[model samples]
Target: MLHRLVEPAHKQQHQFILDRLVGVWLTLGEFMGDGDYGDVIADRRVGVRVEISEGQDRYVCPACEKPMILASHRIQNRTKERFYFKHLFDDGSCSGVAGLGEKAIAALRFGQTKESVEHQRFKFRLLESLELDPSFTNTMAERRWVDEDGVKWRQPDVQAHCNGQRIAFEAQLSTTFLHVIVERMVFYRRNGGRLLWLFRDLDVSHFRLAEEDIFYSNNRNAFRVTEKTVELSRAGKHFVLECVWHVPTLTRGGVSDKLAHGIVRFDQLTFDVSRGGVPRTYFYDYEGARLQAEHRLAERAQTERDQELRQAFENFYLPFLNGELNSDQVETEWPELLSRFRSRGLGLPAWPDNPKGPFHYLLAAYSARAGVPIGTDHEDLVKLAHYLVDKRKHTLWIFRLMLEAYDQKEVMRRYDTTGRWLSKVKQYRDAFRRGDSHYMPNRGFDDLLCFLFPEISDKLVQAPGTFLGSART
Candidate 1:
């Protein structure tokens, strides 16, 4: 069950997140309010406020002013310190264990909306992950530094040190933060620190208004996964995320996302800052090389599919659809779902020479690889689709696969089995849908992406950091 996998990671990540939230929450205390723990509204009749501070702690109630007796106590001393839970209330009216949780969240004023809370928890996880990494040490939160104006201002969020180099990380939950990217980057450049940006998801309105342009790229891949449903989802759960590396820089537009989120992390990262924190040109080259290697390994693992099964996804599902999805319904009810795909390189040419159809096949193939089901309406499916399509737009997925395999094997075999050159194709429409997870595209269709690298490079140059999650300022 999803719970089994997430519960453990949830517990661990929850603790880690709470620790990081301690800093963020505490830093926001004054802005939120000065009381110990309280949540009330303009209509005081509606909300709850539990004030605990000074003399009020040993006792209970602002009314009692009485020295309260300890009703019970359980204390176990350990190396980490001790666990102590006691009840002493002059008023004897408190929510108890459940109240404690409610109060904590109320103090933060976290919204109950799923995305909002998830983002909050995610920000906590991001900070925590950054803290524990050996690559990032010496965490600094809430410090005053003088800017050029000689005026003192508080920092954006957390700054950390690794290998004697300090890096600044800002979790942007509002659109206003977008305008500050260049300023933040300037800070990084001036302070000689690497910048880690956390931008709000643009598609969602929950986040505040933000700028559109400061990032490297917004192109992500598109795909779908059928029969895979989320198991456990909660305020306290976490997921492990992985960085999709090696898509080629010019193609990718230079971007990275915090993995080990959405799912709780299984283990610590090896913490390789050497390859990280380098100039964009450096990182781009590394990803390009790795992607080349991955394509070869993947094609070899392909399984044989019968023609019958191929037809199931071909006419209607060459991209793996059993039939055409209802466009009328999707556009009416989930218009953004369509926009999400179109936004992520769906319209881009797979390569320079041949533009339209190859790009479509590239999206289709990427969807197959990610285990994602094809459709534009469902939220889950849309995200998966966005991821793959974005990848094709940036990597020229089809072409790169062939280009890399050729570079590795010195001969293109499989489809032809004995040919030194990869099968040549007059057009991408030459590709065939062999059914579920199977594709026998036209010759050279496999190299559709790579053939257009020169053009992709030009685009990258014109719009540096324009794809991936680059706008997450």
Candidate 2:
């Protein structure tokens, strides 16, 4: 639903028409004066027409006070569209309209600090309409309020108290910064008042799913809009507002349920508590959209972290994998590698010479992190666990560190057979005592090696049981 206001629009052509008309010398009567432009006002107000014609009498440019005349021309669209504008004399006299382009046209249309007469007209109308509601027992326009302590103060455009709740209605016709809006809202709320933002036109260009617009109601925990109010104003030929509920990230089902309380507007010329205050945002499916957004943020953060770790794995962890490092080489490099991984937001798999030695644990961690499975099946893990728990005749220590490569939740959810394997392993661990297995002192070495280094299981079968004993102990 996010969109940018694409430029080089037909509206720009309208501005060109307007600017050219302004450039021609005009009689005092022809000029609409400050706060009004016929080109702009006529387009918005139905039944009102703008008639720009060629002026015969000598005229003075408003910009340079040089001789000018209304110039008529046709613009090329799909068809030739007639447009008339004021043309200044080109006797190398007037500096006005000398170097005009799209920028100048845009400035003529939009770059104005003073409030247009139309904007003022709409604001006053809305204020008068608000006063008509009896529920707003206390209402004032441009009211300045100071708290009893005199520490907090505010001057709202239109302030009212309805049913003991203080509210300020702001009708915005131009763009405002997010921080300023938030600041005003916070200041009002802190003094026990709520600020309602009413936009003459919603800036769809700035709308984003993740960001909250001015219409977003923090108190009600929803984005609220008075659709009826907007429609009512439109009927009076005041202002037009196009409201859009952005829902690109939301799911399909139960979207209506989350929006039940989001739209507050007058129903049948009467204000009701149920429908006329502030409407909940129908755009976001409350929990679903929030969860999705949070998931995306989390995924992005994890991706950033993973990239760092992957870089470290490539630079540091890869060299240790070829089984070429000596004990001293490993001892010297292992700490730095662990530190680097941790610094880069990657969790170390195990302590050095932990349940298994550093090499086995590193291999498992690398395989898991790299998404490269070492080919150990679920049954092999069960067999390894069973052999360790049930077959050992004597034991210095017991270890249960195989299957460290896989996530517990993933194992539980993705493989139904893993549940049975877990139960079998648990059964043996719970029933067996220390010296009650067949393969004493060196039990489960082959199975452990097979489970840990499945890619080289045949070679690992010939590996020393001392390594397995060292791991178990």
- Best candidate per lDDT, number? 2
Span of 10 residues, lowest total lDDT, candidate 2: 266-275
| List of clashing residue pairs for candidate 2 | 24-86, 261-280, 262-279, 262-280, 263-279, 263-280, 264-279, 393-440
- Candidate 1 lDDT by residue in tens digits, 344-457: 333323221244345454444433333333433423323333343333333223333423322422222222243312222211112221121122333333332322222333
lDDT of each: 0.33, 0.42
How big is the positional error of residue 99 in model 2, measured in Å on the Cα after superposition? Answer: 22
Per-residue C-alpha lDDT of model 2 across residues 1-473, encoded as one tens digit per residue: 32222112222111222223222222222332332333423442111122223332223443443434333333453233223334344564445544676445334333221134544555576666555555665878767877647876666667888668777766544434454555566666567776655554444454332134544442213222344655555555332222334342423331222223233332211111213233222332444456566676666776666666556555544554544557787777678767865665444545444543433334443444343322233243334333434443222122222233333334433443546645644443433343334423243344433433344445334422322311111
Error of 2 at 191 (Å): 7.9
- True-structure lDDT of candidate 1: 0.33
